[model samples]
Target chain A: MRGDLPAPSAAQIDIVEVGPRDGLQNESRVWPTEDKISLIGEAIAYGAKRIEVASFVNPRRVPQMADAEAVVAGCANAPGVTRIGLALNLRGAERALATGIEQVGAVAVASDAFGIRNQGQDRAESVGIAAGIVEMARRSGRSAQVTIAVAFGCPFEGAVDRALVIDIARALAAAQPVEIALADTIGIAGPGEVAALVAEVRTAVAPLPVRVHFHDTRNTANANIWAAVQAGASVADASLGGLGGCPFAAQAPGTAAGNIATEDMIYMLHRSGIGTGIDESRLYRAGRWLDRKLKGSSRSKVLVALPPGS
Target chain B: MRGDLPAPSAAQIDIVEVGPRDGLQNESRVWPTEDKISLIGEAIAYGAKRIEVASFVNPRRVPQMADAEAVVAGCANAPGVTRIGLALNLRGAERALATGIEQVGAVAVASDAFGIRNQGQDRAESVGIAAGIVEMARRSGRSAQVTIAVAFGCPFEGAVDRALVIDIARALAAAQPVEIALADTIGIAGPGEVAALVAEVRTAVAPLPVRVHFHDTRNTANANIWAAVQAGASVADASLGGLGGCPFAAQAPGTAAGNIATEDMIYMLHRSGIGTGIDESRLYRAGRWLDRKLKGSSRSKVLVALPPGS
Candidate 1:
């Protein structure tokens, strides 16, 4: 019913599910590899065609996603669904490539402080990492997406110089990643900033697709996403049930937490008649499952609330 | 520091804190009239130059605001504060005018469906009420603000036609309420929708100030507020911590059940080095008092949390 809104023609956006990696990575709980795989399968059923299953980071650091390979192996039979893995370094990239997944996502933080805090590298270093990962993914004939986190405003540095973000985006443009996503990692962006940056990046990247990732920390993530949408950025990242924000980040650079919910975004787009191939009912179920797994109630307004008057 | 955002000198903006009236009116738990007044005083303490202390609605319908007169009396002495009473109709307006509050706000839903469900009136009928209230206020040399609730989207009718909202806004423009606030009564707007509407309203009402009230029902309130801000609508209506929404509207119209926190908005704008003339610490206190009076925790992200990256 929501999808039939505005009109049937507006639903053309694609949402990439980031909960299995972004969601799980932030929680203190360690889901069993089996449970993690089940989460992935549920997301696929709930209309997640492309899902970031796990990050190939050091197990010592992110003990929860240590079984990245197993999760992908389990998801090998997910029909037409695309399972992407996150890679932080060369080893992570190599491990991701070996999983036979056709796509991999590499992250680069925009602020030097956050880059050191989050990526253990500064801007230039992360750019080099992106280049390496892009080369490997290209060699493997797989799709690569490089995301620039904190591209709008940084919790550490604050209002990152636009020139700096564009410079990295321009460099990543050369690597020719299948996509580049600008992330408001701390939820510091507004729609104007989103539009301005996305417009700049769209021009900088020319024909390349751009995606925007936003955290609902300031309650503006979805609007920023919409701003990005109008600016010609076709891809967006959302977590189910609004799950996932780094616990450390949640304690520090946060007043609230997590990425926008998948179903909520779908509902808005659907209501506006924006085309996203996600199934709302399935996304609702995925939200329910994530809520149970996290032992918490979901925060997605539409997924849980029955109807307006109800 | 989010409110500390640096920017070119801002055009003068007027803010109306609707917490006591809009925020408390819809809350289910009946806060005592005295506690309500204390909340208003605290809201004023938090740098709200304009505060809506209470709604002069019928006590039978809204028992929470029964002592509207007393609430206004309590916050009257806060120096430099402009107090506003919520007047729903002619009777309500008379009661508010009798209380000696120099300014009052009147509301009507633009969507016929919403008007019937909430106001028990048709769109045209409600607009007439608003026009009458504006005339009365003007004759009395009192400033009035007429708000169009559900201006973005309606629950029963789905996406409200922009043209319809625009037309009603056009009609209201003729009466010239000191300000016209567009309410996302249910938090149904996205950034693109927000930008388009703000631009439309600005063009329609040349020099009159436009205020935007958002219910972070769909995690887009802050971003939409930002969009509205850049669209030349400078004033934003935010509860202490996004504490309330239309009980009729409910939640994740995105996630994280709440309104956009006043402190959060001020912080967002402030940290960007924008000037809000608000103190974050005072906002936290107001939020805490509201939470205590309600016998629950404040749902505001920034108010409950200390400071981002603290």
Candidate 2:
């Protein structure tokens, strides 16, 4: 069996499935709420303990997330699974809390240029807004994960400063959210940069768990992820079938606008001897099902390369 | 630009282009001799100091490489470039040397099953043949590099033992070839396995100048390469446009029958602050040319993702 690898490192990492929210938000095809819920269930079956099911954003701006409440309602109460909902502001946080999900996710862009372009706020203003959401989640006895978008690079402002990212992460660290995620919003980070930033953030935030969100735009995300894990960041975000990327940043031809594929990550993590309770076979099936639902081929190399059942 | 990154480690690594030999050998479409020679020239212009141009295998078995001498005659004698010709045995090595190429490459499979299947010899017998080839190259004042095929996994015989790979490396170390390469022929290796094996092999054969050859079969090639480099392997093999895989192992579905793309590896290496001497724009153009010649898309993510002049 291909799964029979040399004993891997003893680190067990958690992959938070973000396809339903981050993936669907950018897809050209808006899957129905029912199909969206079904996809989340499939991810859960593939050993996704924490899943971001929907984003509680304005329906007018993001029509794909129009049925966020309904999607959450369908997936929130799964036994032992931590259902997450993304909230862009305090109102979005309230909406997420209303669904009774335990975790609320929000974004804080690192670059001022990307902050205004993506969220109509400057870096400080965006961090302030995210702080409000994180505070609201805490008051409601819910955990919050504030992801610093463009932490590695920006589309509008190229070459985001490492010090700027670290400063913003430090400021967010004061909010004491359950986790702080550094996102390679444009997928321009290599493993060296990732390791440097993760080490800095891990030291800055200390006990606050550091998570990473990577887009495989340049095909360096897997190596970047390995580097991050080696640098003490335990959590990462992945999409089924390697689906989803920031729509604005994905306009370039053949840009991999997707997060790393769940099955592909599972394979790497498992073979590295890092425990990720995921079932590889089930994850492969999820990728296949996602491909059919999207009416296109998946970007996942493993899903395409390996035949079913090894 | 996507090129600005933290000061990369002060390590300059060598990327040996294998597209012409390992890549074209397995390609279903046999590129014309002129096109093959042109590709080698393009790789040279893209800053490939070491290029593997052809293999002296039986023309009947690998008809694509039948014009090895012609191909070398065109690429050899290029200023500051080392042309390599792969030979499976002394006869092959002699043929390679006759082409006036300074380097003769050979293979020594780690698994007995793959050894028998690929070279019609068992592991010990194949190592003996490779030793003889090395001896011939040494007497002729030609450099030889013996790549241990299926160093990580084998298609016919799965899960090659680590001890067996180390044992093979130890045996070959006595021959004192110019370089020893560990090839993940089936691309089933992960970063942990790669680190472990490279560490063991580096210790087993100090100062042998360890090199790595990876196929992106499981989407873990980049990570594996990263791990290998971290563990002190300074040389890696890549194919232009991510071309080539072992034809024998590529029959399976979704098998990555190609080595990592040269342009993609250059991108990662350069961004990591590891200088590869490869001009990214020139490499991209080469990939574009390769795609056109092959009448298919280039498998390089960086080549396809970014637009011109980015």
Candidate 3:
């Protein structure tokens, strides 16, 4: 029975805090550069070893990340933490490398419809661009990772093909990125599908780590994250206060389609005897801080439901 | 290897719609008797075969359920549906049988602190009363099932012991109730804990179906529900629009700590190829109707994020 499956063998799973970048990028209100830096500092203080500090997208398209260089430079003093910058193409990759960010996150889309709308590229073109970005980062002596977005389902194209995702993983693996990630960009995946896909992707990118990213549009993000971890995913991405939504992804008019909350993820993981090396109490405080800064209640249940001291 | 576990062998899982009873009981705003009957009728039309139409508790304590008898009488003519009534003791069980409801749902608490606060009885006394209610229902030629509440964790006592839950399950199984249920009354269980406990409880009550209930207080309810189903639970309880929370369970002020939404559960189950026999589209309509009647938005993500026709 699945219940009897051995507990996750890894003593600790790496959590990639994406609050500063992905979490803030989707909000209509653009946060100041100082607040972004403070968010990263708080995350580091809460024991987040890997964090996505900013994305190197076009300023006009993603004005929320317009101060990426300033944000990246502000956090350069932090020691013993891997700062990541998300990039969709070689131009963004060059910009990220220019900032001396520790890691470059290259994104590839699994569907042509989403790819065209999201980054003005087709599926094949997106994969090639992501691979080129990885190669550029490697030449610059920085680590790079590839994330296949809409790997599970696409809002515009509907069901994404698993074979297409596998093919993308294999092609990206040749570039020898640090890991391959499968992203439920639309939050349309169930646990079974996540387990099967993560397992297949892990096999496809042998020896390379598997990371998982999920949106909570359908309220299955935590379950999908747990399923991915159980299927051998070693790293997962979450945002503080569950503050994120893809600006391009279709959603209800006023609903905040956020990612799985970082605090909630840590709570589930730590309570299950799984090590995340992240402090739950501190994350709760950080969530509250972010909520206050945004003048909005946190989308994370733990932050709202449980006191930080608890 | 866990991913390879065969899909749920059961072709169909029973979903006991608890919106009318558990859903409305927690809300401060009392829904009229006609609205309660309309909710039940809509649920039946949405293909829910079993429903908890009302509860026979103290009208003064749970004024939202003050019209229990009227709701029961209004729904009595519905055929092919097992109408369930919740009761905490023998007197309530007698009232349930007197109303000609199909099943009596007796609730037992696993923790003394929560048990006493929730139903004016401690752990041992609550189990004894639950067993007595089951016996009373059996004597009246009616079906009865016992639900062990706070089996995962308690608000006042914190972590509940697995041994205690198993003992209660064994005690309830001896009464030969139709099934045994474990409820996360305060929504504090992780997937790992849920899987292990459900497996143990299923073993203790061999051949008697295991039903699972959860509140999304901490955003782990869907994950926990999926884990329970994977661990061999044959039945689940959900509310329309995710419209239920324990009146006695501690929660964040102003936050709706509702149960897993019936539409969300159906979406996950049916998408994974497990049959729920419930129509997701109709559930969306029902959710919207409930939202309008209550003058509040649904707690269900699927209803808010996806269009009804989608």
Over B64-125, each residue of candidate 1 has an lDDT whose tens digit, in order, gives 88888887776655678888888878888988888879787888777777787666777888
lDDT of 3: 0.84
Residue pairs in candidate 3 whose N, alpha carbon or C atoms collide under 3 angstroms:
none
Second chain alone, TM-score for each candidate: 0.90, 0.93, 0.93
TM-score of chain A of each: 0.92, 0.93, 0.94
Best by DockQ: 2
Off by over 4 Å in 3: A1-6, A9-11, A246-249, A252-256, A308-310, B1-11, B246-249, B252-256, B308-310
Q: Ten residues in a row with the worst lDDT in model 1 chain A?
A: A1-10
- The docking category that best describes candidate 1 is acceptable
Supply the DockQ value of model 1.
0.29
* Candidate 3 lDDT tens digits, B183-214: 98777788888888889889999999999998
* Worst ten in a row by lDDT for model 2 chain B: B247-256
On DockQ, the stronger of 1 and 3 is 3
Model 1, residue B107: what's the lDDT? Answer: 80
The alpha-carbon lDDT assigned to residue B259 of candidate 1 equals 64
